[model samples]
Each structure stands twice: as structure tokens, then as C-alpha cells.
Target: MTTALDIQGLRKTYHNGFTALKGIDLQVEQGDFFALLGANGAGKSTTIGIVSSLVNKTAGKVNIFGYDLDTQREQAKAQIGLVPQEFNFNMFEPVVEIVVNQGGYYGIPRQEAFVRAETLLKQLGLWEKAREQARNLSGGMKRRLMIARSLIHQPRLLILDEPTAGVDIEIRRSMWEFLRKLNAEGTTIILTTHYLEEAESLCRNIGIIDKGELIENTGMKQLLNRLDTESYVFDLASPLEHLPATSSNLCHCTLLDPTTLEVAFHKEHYSLNQVFSFLNQQSITVQSMRNKTNRLEQLFLELVEGNKA
Candidate 1:
């Protein structure tokens, strides 16, 4: 019930007269895995920067875990750990030293910081390379090291900005699992990534920004439910010369090939069973089926496009 992060009437404008955030308002509940989504130059980074105190906000009220950022700057900052999109650590520093030194910036004792650094390195699968210079580690290893450094202070709220960018799928999945575990252990996380599937799988709530405006903010399920229609691809068990007719007039079917069919239907009017039954009646046997597009990605595109209109 407690709020982890809150922003009210937030605004940011550059000296060049470009507005990056236009009176934005958002909140993330304690213990929630929340996603902040937007296309490039959509103010996602600016919002994160302000929250992390890396960039100055033109005007706004920001509260982190009940501490107002203006009056309790240290307290608010102490509760947040940010893993930015770009790597910011010293390239020449040893992997373990980078993480250990981060804790010192928060006034953590050097001995305690070293212990926490080792633990995090091991947990993030970078312990074996603890002595290696950050510049020598692979891209995925660098990413893991950044995450480890972020966790050195053991902050209650973690903000990740495209944490998996440029990493391979295997490494990305590993990072996701680690983050999921962290969230389950009560560290509220706010994630911003181009990968909508990652958001759909990891976040319970979402806020989408477009052109300096917060266009959508709600439970993920509620947002997905707002989608009126969905398309599904069904692989037929046998080849078909032409398309088959279905009873539901609300559903549209197209044949992409002899063994493939694409069905588009209003979610409110048609069920999977209805589609299956219709295909069965027409002697079409399905081999497999899948969504035509990632549900979250489809909805995100629509929301951004609709906001433009």
C-alpha cells in the first residue's frame, strides 16, 4: 500500500527550448515491478535522470519511499540504485573494485563494501572475473558488473535503463532471472527497455510515455484488456488449397500459405474455442498456434500512435 516512487506535476525543458517532460505524473507502489516504456527521445531517460539526481528537473515534486527529494536528498538517493543504459564505470578499474568503491560513495564502510561487492559479484556470475579489468570483460559481463555495482548499497528501489541492451539472448535471460529474484525478495524495481516482451513478463504494472507526455499508466492486465482485437497464427496439420469459412462474422481469416492460417478476431466477440470449433467443422486440423505479435508491443504501438493523432 505504500508508494515506492511518486512524481507530481513533473516538468523538464532544455535550454534550447525543447520540452522533454510535460507535466508528468506517476507513481510506483512498494514491492511492485513497474515498467516505464517509450520510444526514443520520449523522455524516459530524462525522467530517470531526474529521479536519480543526474539531471536537474525544471519543476516537480519527487518522493522516494516517503522521502522528498528536495529536502531529503541524501535519504531519497540512498534508497535508489540506478543502472543506466550506458556503461559509466572506469574501464581500467578491476571488476570488484568498481563495485566496492560505489558503496564508499554512499558512506558505507570499506570492509563492509568489499564483502557486499564479493557477494554480488558471485551472485551475478562475475566473481570469477573479479580481478579482471572492466574493459576486458565481454559486453554481457560488463552489464552484469554494472548491476552488481548498483546493488552494492543494497537500495530498496532499483531503476534499470535498458539493462539488457546489446547483450545476447542467453545473458539477457540470466539477467531477467536475477532481477526477478531480486523483485521477489522485496526490492521494488522500475524498468525501461525497448523489449516489450521483457516488460510483459517481468512487470505487473506499466506506464507508457510518448512525446513528453505520460499517455498510459495502469495495471498491465488492464492495459492489455483494452486491446479490442488480437491476431493469431495457426499452423494447419495438412495443406489447404484455399481459406475456410467460419461461423463467426466478427472474425477474419486469411491464408498465408497452404499450411498456415492467420485469424484476426475481436477479443470480446470470439473465443479460442469458437475458432477451433469453426476450423474443426471445416475439416482443418491445427498443428500449432501463436500470437501474430507480442501483445504488449501491439498495444504499445497503438497507444503511441493514437496519442500522436
Candidate 2:
């Protein structure tokens, strides 16, 4: 597969000697829905900032479609669109003009810009308010507008920085559907969000970063499988008078609720069959038995906690 975005030994450090990003290497394939996950103050924002040319990196290389970012800034930027975490447009400007103006800055002709702007406004469900001042729009509307503005040049790679951060559920769902459709249409998407469930559901690949370092980079399915290897959740028949003590052989078992037992074990040593056998021998009937899927949230916690340790 062709690479849409490639980073090699990427590093960033502030003047005061604060390291924001370590030597990180990553590749985003063409038309991929890639998710970047990390805790606050991790290099997530810095990574996006460098790719979007908003932040200067202390060192490293970033290439977009074979074009080096620093050497071919214009061409590289032209092939990418960034929807920042904050709305940066002039609030006094009309919504349609704000989008059209962005196209103009990209050297797209006025007529073409107008056509694209109109289409985007309508497609994003903002056409009715196209003539309204952006300041009059709600927060969700502002986010939709920013997305429309970023696509004025129709870039192949779209980087969304916490795109659904402050939006309501309905609006976030709408944005997700829109993004999914765009990905299906061959646009590569790189998203950084706190919503791990969203990333697990939408992204094919994921990268976890911590304290400016890349901790894990792998296929989403594989990462989740690592978490599921020997984990199980048992919906018990009822709350027990005394909790079942886990032996050293049993690994870790946590009581998530009165009726749920979440357990994790190493597959090489333990199996779900063993769990069932033990429960059966104890004559404890289970309401349900299911694998406990590993999530980005859990992976993130592990990363941060490990770093602290």
C-alpha cells in the first residue's frame, strides 16, 4: 500500500528543554482510518501540529506522498487538510465565505472555490446557515464549518484533532458517519481523540503514545486480541456471600460489580475452559460468559501507569 504520511525518528523539544515528542516512527497508509491514542500532554497534539505545519519540530522527517514536508512544504501541505481542535476562522465572516476564502488561500480560483464551498456547506448540513455569521452558529455548527473549511482544497489526507471533543452525541455521531463515508470514498483519515471506543470501532490501525514516545504501533484487531488473549467477564448468577479468592495460578480477578467478575490471565498458562471448570466444580452457575475485549482506554492506562512506575 502507498504511504500517505510517514514519520521517521520524529522529535520535538521546546527551548526550555521540555521534550514534547521523542524519536517516533509511524506510517499511515493511503485511505486508512488511523487512530492516534494517548493521554493528555502526550505528543498527540504536537504530532498533528508538526504534520499540519503549525508547530516546528526540533528534529526528524515527515513525508507526505513522497514529498518531504520541509523541502516541499507547499506541495505537502496542499495534499493534506487539517481540522484543528479550535475554530480559527473569523467569527464575523459568513460561513460560506469562510470556507471559500480558505480555498482562495490555496490558490484555487474563485469560481471553483464557490462551487466547492456551496457543495460542502450543503453536504455538511450548513447550507441553510451559509449566509449567517459564523459567530451565530452553535458549537457543533462551528466544528462542522471547520471541517468544511479544511476540505476546501480537497486534500487526500485529513487530520482531525479531537474533532468531536465538545460536541453532543447526535452531532458527534453525524460527524463520525460523515468521516466514515469520506474514508470509504478513498480519503485517508488520521484522528486523535479521547474517545477510545470511537477509535476502536472506526480505525483499522492504532498507535499509542506516551510522554512523547511511541509505545505501541499495530493493527487495531491485533492490539485488541492481545487484550483478549486470556481475559473473560462472567456475569454471575448473584452476589456471593464471600468473594472467591484467586490463587497465584488464577492470575487477577476483579469484582467489577456485584454480579460481574472480570478476570485476566496469560493464555499460555490459563484458559477460559479452566474458568468454566472451576465454576462448574464449585457449582456456581453463570448467567453469561464472554471475552473481555481490550480497549484503547485500558491500553492507555497501562502505558501511563507503566511510564510512572
Candidate 3:
């Protein structure tokens, strides 16, 4: 039940009088894998900047692991590791040096830093290129290097902003596995990504921000439960000239193709058993079935649109 991060009445305004955050409030529990989602200009980056001390907040409070950021800046910072959206490391520095040097900034001894650097580099698949300049590494390797650098100090809370933005699918999946392992080992993580599917798969709780306001903050399952209808695509064993008619008004059926059908229904009003019975009555055998859209994506869109209205 310990809190890893807490933000109260946080606000930020730029020089041009543009407010990036409007009395925002958030809390993250220890060991929780949380997702902070927003569209561009939604103040996600602004909030992160304030938390990391890159930008001064106009008003409010930020606490990291019970250390007040204002009174105990160093202690608060020592508990956070940030992997920004853009690569900010020295391009000319050797990959290993970049990571090892970060440890020094956190007061870690040189010898211990070297050992940690080697272990992280090897684990992230960057040991072979440890001596190479960071600029010489591929885009994916650069991203991995950033992650390795962020973890050099072994912070309790890690915040990743668009960590997989430019990585390929295979590399992205590998990073997902690595992050999952890190979370399982008790690191509280805050993830900001445009990939709704990634958030849905990896996070247990979600907070969605839009137009400098937090629109939704709740457990992932709770948000998903608000969705009354779910659409599914069913592949049939045999082709048909048309979709079979069903007497149940609770379900809406459509013919996607000769051998494919789409069924949408309210979760409370219908069940898979009803769908199966209807298909059996029409002599249609289902080969397979899958969701038409990701549950999280559907709810996210709904929340964003509701906020807009």
C-alpha cells in the first residue's frame, strides 16, 4: 500500500501563457505498472518534465517515495529513472561509458558502477557494442542503451516515455518482456505510449489525460467494464450466401464475407451460448473467433470523445 509517486494540484504554464497542466492530481502505488496516456499536447510530457525537474511547475506538490520533491530534491530524484522519448545521450561517447557515468551522478562508486554497467549492457544485448560510439548503434540499440542507462542507478520508480516509438515489432516485444521482468521484480513503472495495445497488455491501472486535464483514472478492468457492447468476428467452417437470421434482438449480426461473420452484443444482455445456439440453428460452425477491436482502445476513444464533448 506504499505510495511510490504522488502529485497534488500540479500546474504548469509556459511563457506564452499556455497552461500545460491544470491542477493535476495523481498517485502511483509501489510495485504498480501504471500507464499514463494522452494525445500530443495533452500535457503528458509537461507533467514528466516537472516531475524530473526539467521544467519548473507553476504550482503544486510532487512527492517521490514519500520524499517531498521541493524539500528533498536530491532524494526524490535519486528514486526516479527517466527514459525520455528522444535520445539525449552523448553521441560521441562509448555506449558503456554513457551508462556507467550515470551511476557516478547518483553517487555510486566507480568500481561498482562498472560491474552494474557490464551486467545491464549484457542483459540488454548491448555488450558486444559496448565499446562503440552511441551514434554507431542502430535505432533499437540506442533505445536499449537509454533503458540501460536509466537503470544504472537502480531507481525504485522508472518512467518510460514512448520507449518503443521507433523500434521494430520484434525488438519491441523483447523490450516488453524485459520491462515485464523488471516490474515483476518490484520496480514501480510509469509508462507513456501511443500504443494502446501495449498499455492494455502491460498495465494494471490507467490514467488518461486530455487537454491538460485528467479525464479518467481507474483500474484497467474497471474502465473496460464501462463498455457495454463488444464486437467479435467469427470465422465459419463453410461459406454461405448470406448471414443467417437470428430471432434474438439482443445481438446484431453482419456478414463480413462468405465465410466470416461479425457479431456485436451487449455483454449484460447476451452470452456466447446464445451466439453458438444461433449459429447452430443456421447450420454454421464457427472455426474461430476474435475481438474486432482492443477493449482498451475502445474505452480510451470513448473517454477522449466524451471529454471533448
Please name the candidate that would achieve the greatest lDDT relative to the true structure: 1
Clashing pairs in model 2? none
Candidate 2 deviant stretches above 4 angstroms: 228-294
Q: Across residues 1-309, which tens digit of lDDT does each residue of candidate 1 receive? A: 899999999999999999999999999999999999999999999999999999999999999999999999999999999999999999999998899899999999999999999899999999999999999999999989989999999999999999999999999999999999999999999999999999999999999999899999999999999888989999989999978876667899999999999999998999889888888889999999999999999999999989989
TM-scores of the models, in the given order?
0.98, 0.84, 0.97
lDDT against the true structure, per candidate, is 0.95, 0.89, 0.94
Rate residue 308 of model 3 by lDDT. 86
- Which parts of model 3 have CA positions greater than 4 angstroms off? none
Clashes of each: 0, 0, 0
Q: How well does candidate 2 score on lDDT at residue 178? A: 95
Model 1, runs deviating above 4 Å = none
lDDT of 3 by residue, 212-277 (tens): 998889998888899999899999898989767767777899998998999998899888887788
Total clashing pairs in model 3? 0
* Rank by TM-score (best first): 1, 3, 2
- lDDT, residue 17, candidate 3: 99
lDDT digits (tens) for residues 38-127 of candidate 2? 888999999999999999999999999889998999999999999998889999999999999999999999999999999999989999
